[model samples]
Target: MAQPDVPWPLLRSVEALADAPLAQIADRLRQATLPYMGSSALVIFTEDCTGRPQKKAGEEEIISRVSITELDSLRATIPDEAPWFGHAEIAGRSRAVLALKYAPSHALLVLTDPQPLESTPTPGLEMVRYLWRIAARRIQEKVADAPPSYLLESRAASAERLRVTAELTDLHSTTLETLLAALRSPSLDDAAARSTVTDLAAKALVALRTLSDRTTDLVEEPVATAFERLREDLKPLTRFGGVEVEFIEPPLNGRALPGEVAHAARAIVRGLVLTMMEEPEVSRIRTQWDCDGENLLINIRDNGSGTLSADAPSIVRLDRRVQALTGHLQLEVMPGWGADVFVTLPLDPPTRPAGDVAEWNLAARELEVLQHLVAGRRNRTIAMTLGISENTVKFHVRNLFKKLDVNSRTEVVALAHSHGIR
Candidate 1:
């Protein structure tokens, strides 16, 4: 009875059935009966491997839909026919049975018209069998092509749980740092310490809440989102220090750098704050960050004693950290005024030639000298251009060669040329 006039649209339009997963396909066939029978109630069954047919879907009407147990009992009463379509007496009423072999693995059975049959030929039975074949093929295709829908859903849920765990780890780290700072306070009283602990707890809660908001249902969050959440969590610290910190541009929405870089940056900024300001005098601190094509620029300025000692250990450590990243740090300290700290980090470091130019951890000044050296300039010419002594130029060149692991000026020149350093 399978024909081209079958109701394909009805079968395809069932929201979750078009790509029917194997486990749910039987239910889909059962649900099909409501539309196929053009009645409020219908029952459907599909035979399992053991010749026992299981009831799949139906309405709750007592007289119309039969349960799987009832269908199983009635299975022995069904006749084997070429295109099984017939009527039978069940519970003292004549009900129509339409059975069709959907695939080698399964067969569909629709039980309807329990009261009496209208004498006319009902194409509905034929249509039901046709739709079953289409649905069976679709279920087979989905099984062959991909994992079941439930399996994918489970995987996605697992990934989300892992992400939340990582976020919790980050929150714990921040909390530990704050607690360590609080414990170092000089005015250690029982009450004051308790208050400090409370404050830390509140801050941790705020951080966790912010992180949860940003990361809900996110399998992989962008670095920018994480940074923005951190900024929000640290807002309370700004009020404590009388500093009005702001992020000039949006948080960076890109891949995350290694955690070491983020940790080092945080340390440097913290040291700058502690070194330049007393507990009560500093009014405001503004941090601005931006990207300029090839480099990332972070500027931290504070309204504090701008005077910085040349031998300040904190600043020295910060400078070393920045330099190690192949970046430059500028400290503009104006005594009796505010200070501005500027950092520039290249997107990628230039490649050094083999053996030569390998050991050279080029200082900013030496980098300038090497640039000139790569331009084919002699030490005297470089000194004249940089407004430095020829002896100073030689000193820088010597350091450059040592850092670059180069033996001679010719090797340096060749390495620079090969790397397009000029």
Candidate 2:
């Protein structure tokens, strides 16, 4: 039988979750179906060996309130391949729970305060089942062989530091260049030049002083720093494990990568290491990174007997992460020899022009607020600078969050930064 076409939104949701952390999977599913299904809270969880529902790091609060006994009852009521949708009382609140068995584990997607569906197609529920299946597989992999506890935490911290430092460097560099240009302006009076320099100098001094007590590097080249950090991250892995990872430095003259690219590349390499480590006999690996002005090329080769394929479960996860950035992953395996993986990530900014808040139908004032929000300005500071009241700033921020489909300031900043909205 011919299969029906999948919905575009559902497909995009699957792709987004491909590289997303397990904790964020439920929310991603919720957001993807929100347009058709209406606003509702969602949660995903799996059962442990003892039949107790275990929570992933990013599980929502509402899901936490549902008792394990309720989940067990739902599982018993629904067939493994089918979904059950019904109202249930959880934690003194009535919610609609969609229960399904997604392979090795059972997942419950609870919709709290769910609005009644007005003749939505059955295919919508099927799509939800498919999405949950994908998430379930990822959760199982984590259960089988998760990364060391500190790897993700350390990588996240490092990435944030790099992002903030990179942004600050760009800001100060532009400010200094503009200050120089202002000084060289032919129409500028000596008094105006001095005043301009004094004001800029004071701001720069404050910035420098604030960053001095921190270990953040403001002027370092990004690509080199990425490789250096990769080495540090792999140090513990190499030291304890029998593997020896040979690091080949990229050309020093190559163009630097954006902060996000550098961070993602480091993460990609780290993931590759973890994947290859699954082979018990894998003792030696060689990794290289290069930037060809347009794309970041990464090559990794291992000396163990080739057992991992391009489509291996772990590699599939890695591929999703690369694809999230519009990048590509290639794997070469020699059955008796070894495996080689290559990744290509673009260096260009996203095609969408930054500050084009029109896509989100953001008002002019809201766009102004978004820019300041991306710059890490506080609500009070934004209000003062825009000459608006504090309450007005809050109103605009709320609108920004709603328009951007994000919940927190960090997500808004990250999304805007990815779109080249500096």
Candidate 3:
């Protein structure tokens, strides 16, 4: 007699079973197989670390009574010549036992109705073997096709992305360093510094666009167009400070940048101008800019008293901001003559776009908390680092959660990391 055919839909169901936890998959297998066998109980077993066949699924009572040691003993009794189908009386009831090796390393045993075994036995045995093979193959296939766990995979990907981001950040820092070096040089005149600033601004804008395009997908529209605006904005500082600004390559229209970075850049420039204004009798200031593949170089110089000390509080604060974003800031103050401030910022903003107010509208202090949160610091640690009380930290955290629409620390960290906050 020919064996019954297997259901194609049942095989297709295996595809959806992939990526399920092992326990769920085993339970699914038991449910699928039990109906065909007319069995009240089903048990699936796999080898454990100790070389014992461990029961993976079935009724607890049935599993407890079925011993792996006894099964091994029974297998030993079956000779190589013994037919795969046999009668087995266990716990007083006589049942049909069918055995088949599905994979090279795995075996299956089915215990089923006794009535069919006594009549038309061959087809029943063949069908049982076929079903076992299908089940085993499906299980292995599902296991092999499992998707990666999001928690692990996402974190690893984020880490790799951050490393690449840091490298790009270094390019901006190098640009600042070159600019600062030129500003500090006694020999560079107003004309030379102005030329350097213009060139540096143009090149920095290109680098910014390149970095922005490469690292983030959610960049602001205005970022691509703000390069010229930046140069124009900086022009007044040189002019008013008695510094001549030259554009070797005029600033180009680049993509809109994150509002925060652009705002911060403006703030830094404003701060530099304010610092310069504190001194009188400074006659000439020259600012220049250029790009050399790896970095954007900006040079600003003045013939005034270079009396700015690197250790000043304002300088230290600027340094902290630069260092936090993996950039660099240098200051040179030569007494009675001139003061030069050089700042480098990454082409990519240190923070990702927090999106419109609807998505992640953060207040100033909340943004500060987010920055620390991304560093993987604990609440108490963040409180200490920020010089706030633990209670204040909790308050900020609660507020941050509400603003960012995140519920947990982990989610906040993921969000922060994605946006380049840390």
Give each model a TM-score.
0.30, 0.44, 0.31
Can you give the lDDT of residue 74 in candidate 1? 49
TM-score top scorer: 2
Give the alpha-carbon lDDT of every model. Answer: 0.54, 0.65, 0.51
TM-score (C-alpha) between model 2 and the true structure: 0.44
Question: Model 1 over residues 93-174: C-alpha lDDT tens digits?
Answer: 5566544555333444555452222432455555555556666566434422332222222223233333444667576767
lDDT of 3 by residue, 1-422 (tens): 99898766556545534434433544555554444444534444432111112323454444446544344434555554223556554323455654344443244454433223334333544444555555565544432232222222223233444454566577776776677666666776687766778677667756655554544432222432334555666676666655454434424443344333343444455455555556566555555434333223444555666666677776666566555444577777777767766666554423445433335767777888887877767889988888989999989998986665443454567556555554
Listed per candidate, the RMSD to the true structure in angstroms reads: 34.6, 17.1, 30.0
Clashes of each: 7, 0, 39
Would you list the rank order by lDDT, best first?
2, 1, 3
On a 0 to 100 scale, what is the lDDT of residue 155 in model 2? Answer: 30
Q: lDDT by residue for model 2 over 12-87, one digit each (tens)?
A: 8778877666446666767766655553456554532111133322235654355544554555676656656677
After superposition, the stretches of candidate 1 with alpha carbons farther than 4 Å from their true spots are 1-223, 229-236, 251-260, 355-422
